[model samples]
Target: MSIILTVRRIDIEETLNTTPSVLPQIKMTAQLNEDRIWIDGCFDFVHHGHACAMLQARRTSNNKENSMLFCGVHNDAAIEYNKGTLPVMNAPERYAHARSIRWCSAVVEDAPYVTAPEWMDRFGCQYVIHGDDVTLDANGEDCYTIMRKMNRFKMVKRTYGVSTTDIIHRILTHNTLPSTDKDYFPTLDELEFCSKGVDGFSNHCYVFQDDLNNMLVRGGYDWDSTNSVLILGDFDLFHMGHIDQLKKIRNVLEPRRQIIIGVTSNESKEIIMTIKERVLSLLSCSFVDGVIIHPSKDTIENSSHDEKSKFSKVYNIDSPELVDGTVFSGYLTSRTIIARIETQRDMYVERNKRKGMPI
Candidate 1:
């Protein structure tokens, strides 16, 4: 969905109380008496993934008189660890974004870190919402321990690719410095950008892709991804739109989902000139882990499936050596889109997609 720009920063308390453009809308505690929902976070960037979560929360509410909806944001220090630098968007910006989403009835600058069970007990939140992606932490403890405490919890599984970290990356890629030398080899971002049919555009941390053929091995991951999702296309002539799609997919894939983008490699050199490039184009992005050719006979497929899944995924892509406008308008590759739920997450693949781009 294309964004229709509106006001950047506005006071929620002020708008709801005095602005003629806005109306007085108080937290409907009575309406939500039996239904107390909490969205936990510092929500530093407050981008698309946040929006997705809010959308899901609202969906469950159904504008019902019986449901009461609320959201909470973490204080500055709490958010910093997840986001690098100065938490790109501040508390005011974060509140402004959350307020715009009507699903959220209240906003509080919560403490730095509070476990789910603790928070639920403190707020009496009848239902705590989480995305399907939440899982066991490094210590082997499930991330949703508190929510699991009671059946009142609700987990929303939405399409991926909308995330704050992703928004940061898009902002960074939009401002990538001019190419310089070997460093100029295609960027994982560039390959990922091309993979999704390039916009003329554009993470952190904390996830393990150990299964060998992660979400990148196949396809179909929806979320503002920390994990990468692979998209295959000829991508001969890159443009702004192509860039945007990659940003969208990267953000929408599973969290920390690195991308493994595949650019078409012509079978005959007579059709195109030789260009020196790296195995992966985008190396600078914190999100993309690596890149690769459309999958070769020697590549290792995941342990989950015995068939050459990696090669099979690449085989579905349809491409030609030619670079033209029609490719983006409508393009395909000779490879298949592949994803593995467990095998080495899609992130490395996302990073490596940039391997073949011309400087």
Candidate 2:
């Protein structure tokens, strides 16, 4: 015997403008909710700038409690065709990067470079969000023109002082200034820009708190010492590799085990991002349950007993023991990212120069 299933077709128009009388049942039964917001990008380098856009979109929802921010990552072909250059990270890497963001509810892979209303409709996204900066296609037309014409577009402030271009510029120039140097560190305003919409840590605290002193930034989840796992690392640049490692830890560990991240405040000359920036980056990850900002080597060893007793299992990512074989060995590390730019130094320098960025 064979069984047949009948699926109900939902009218997109009715769902968008549903009244109490018209398709009231359909509204409640619809798989896609009205609070879904769409944001698409190449997300080549996956920096705080991309994270901020998604955060702003989630904050803009009509019902914050139930809002779902769907992130659409464009494929390599689309990026190459529209931007005249292939993305530094491939599509799978880009998708994984977007998936790790705390604000992203879902990841849509292989999205078109140009925003299509049909694609947005298919996801039942009420509005399409993007940064204020204009994105143009190959023919010099606005990428979001279709969404703008339909009045289903929303714009958030573009994060300044940081971009893939700027990162590439720094790599090409080998600008590894000390984190304490005023010129090297991001300004208070720029730091606060990325810290906004973070749940547990206040923007002021996140920006002004001295990482040299020990501090803990808790996630939105409540602490439960009985069911927690501690992982420590510098987490500089917070790329897909970090996300993959966190995912593996989650998979291997017991279900519902909270993964707390311990970020070392190492002022090493090799460190690219500051401790605060690193903390913010880790906090933005969906897998991270909390972040503990600990002082360098000896200081951590001398930490108070009360702080030390919180976790039953501790895994140092720099030298993992518990999840030895499960650790990710991907090519998405900060070193490799810098190397990618270093290998293509002239190309990146010329790209930044064309964008009017200081060489």
Q: Using lDDT as the measure, which candidate wins?
A: 2
How far off is model 1, as Cα RMSD? 18.0
Candidate 1 positional error at 66, Å: 4.0
lDDT of 1 by residue, 1-359 (tens): 11111222234333431232342232222121234456766665443345456546645654344343456666565554433233444565455445433345555445334445544444345566778865443354565675577565678874353343333333323332223444324334433432221111112111112223333322223333223344454332222223334444445423344555444445532111111122211221223334444433234232224342332222122222222333231332211101111132243234323322112
TM-score of each: 0.38, 0.78
Clashing pairs in 2: none
Candidate 2: stretches off by over 4 Å: 1-34, 181-219, 224-227, 265-269, 294-299, 307-310, 318-328
Local accuracy of candidate 2 as per-residue lDDT tens digits, 146-261: 88988889999987756887667666776755656665444455444444443312332232232324333322344454476667777877777777778777766544787767
lDDT at 193, model 2: 47
